[model samples]
Target: METAVKTTWKIDTAHSEIAFKVKHMMISTVTGYFEDYNAEVNTTKEDFSDAEFSFTAQTASINTKNADRDAHLKSDDFFNTKTYPEMKFTSTSFDGTTLVGDLTIRDVTKKISLEVDFNGVVVDPYGQTKAGFEISGELNRKDFNLTWSAVTEAGKIVVSDKVKLQLNLQFIKS
Candidate 1:
């Protein structure tokens, strides 16, 4: 007889964050995050190769610390929040520490690969099991049609076409 084991993890929103950075004015960088997001993971074994992850982020939660700027980002020039209210990512493969997935934003879908490092898994004093992971990746914004920008006086685009994504995710076993 064979035994099967599966574990489920729910994202700890308060302890996790998703953020992105892109060049601005060819001299500085701008950073922001989606205020609301949800994700879950399931694994059939202790190793994460057989794991699955899926996440959804609310488009209206764009926050750059500036209300005016955030509102502009939600406009048609950028995410066009009225038409696409959410962004999502679904993992297709998890090979040890590498992850291959598809990310969909503003109605555009692109395949992205990330190098993930499993910080560790621990059992907390409260008897809860938790797993920590850090992932980093870069993607060309233009590839996803996030092409809103303006030429600066210095002859540079106000926003760079490359966007860098970084995620620190902590999940509690449920």
Candidate 2:
């Protein structure tokens, strides 16, 4: 009988971040993050092609350095954290550096693909094995039911409908 080996990884939050950017005022881009999230990866060796991954983010933890703006985002006009407090992702397939998964947000589930670059693995000075990844993907907010906008007096939508996501994750083998 052949025994299968799997490696598990726990996200290092202090060294990981999830962020997004969107066009604002049709002139500049606004960026922000959830500030709190958790992720895990299970794989054979270091090949993501054989990996299973999942991540969860607290919707109410969004932070843009502005309390008022953050509060507004958590209101019913946006994430409506009281109703849907968590956003989640689970991978369904991995092809080389690309990951296909289902992302759930605001009670809507959408299939999304991410282009990932495995930054290879390293052995830290503390004698721990770790891996680093820089992954990015974009999804239309409308598809996830995040549609909320206002037309400005200048005729521009107060908010853009498209949101771009970027994730930087560092994981320690467990």
Candidate 3:
């Protein structure tokens, strides 16, 4: 497709999720989701190739379904929510199937690549045009300065550095 006029898209947060999982104690995986987040995309193609994407998730919004653990995660050892307060991503390139972006957390930024499965665009019952995407990736938490460490009494690691990301996103054309 030729470069057309760029269209703006807003995230449909009510139907989307920004989630990640990391091994806990080297035996179990703990899943967490950001309860508050937003994303914007501007693109000239309906397929979203070469789009300019920006995303942000509140660091304090991290939820793992556990209160104490959640609070701990917000402390200095991890996100230090009060200090950094937000996680952000800005896309550098998109090729329909892959996305390369600079992901920032705790004020640290790193270029990361993610696999994107464009689920195509559709009009909803409300006559709104929406696009769906499944994006997945992995990164070392330590890479972003989230270097809190711990150990189990039995000599097991508390939190694994490797985090797996799975984001299901829906965006509406505006």
Candidate 4:
């Protein structure tokens, strides 16, 4: 009997991004990114049909191009970096198109499905084998204990509950 060695692919943070968008005041969109994050996947198949992925991002690393907004996100009103400094996700299944996983934020975990687009693999000019993927998903902020809310004096919402997540990932086989 022969044992197959699973190939481990680690995210190249320099070429990857973890970003999200949420409606602000029911009028405009606010975009944010986690400056520190990492992901890894192990697979035995060439097409990655059997790959299992796990990822995490530091809550304190949230950046929205605005210091005040970033600080607010790290406060108790949102991620609460002082208490839960990280968010995580682990894949349960992947079927080439849809990926079902458990996402944890602020100690609250929930199952979520994400659309995956495999951008194929290639050897970079630096002689490194790399794979790319564009993944998207959405979640309700309140579902993860990020339940802070506010209403304008005009009876409008200060923030929408829905948050759209986008991840552009690049991995190097390690």
In the range 96-132, model 2's lDDT, one tens digit per residue, is 6999999999989989999998998999999988899
Candidate 1 regions off by >4 Å? Answer: 1-3
Give RMSD to native, each candidate.
1.1, 1.0, 1.5, 1.0
TM-score of predicted model 4?
A: 0.97
Candidate 2 TM-score to native: 0.96
lDDT at residue 98 of model 3 (Cα atoms): 90
- Which is the leading candidate under lDDT? 3
TM-score of 3: 0.97
**Candidate 3, residue 102: lDDT:** 98
After aligning candidate 1 to the native by TM-score, how far in Å is the CA of 83 from where it should be? Answer: 1.0
lDDT, ranked from best to worst: 3, 4, 2, 1
Candidate 1, residues 80-159, lDDT tens digits: the string is 89999999999999987888999999989988999899888899898989999998899998787788889977788888
- Candidate 3: 10-residue stretch with minimal lDDT: 44-53
Candidate 3 residues 13-128, lDDT tens each? Answer: 99899999999999999999999999998999877887888999999999999999999999999999999999999999999899999999998999999999999999999999
Error of 2 at 91 (Å): 0.4
Which scores higher on lDDT, 3 or 4?
3
Candidates 2 and 4: which is better by lDDT? 4
- lDDT of all predictions: 0.90, 0.90, 0.95, 0.93
Name every residue pair that clashes in candidate 4.
Answer: none
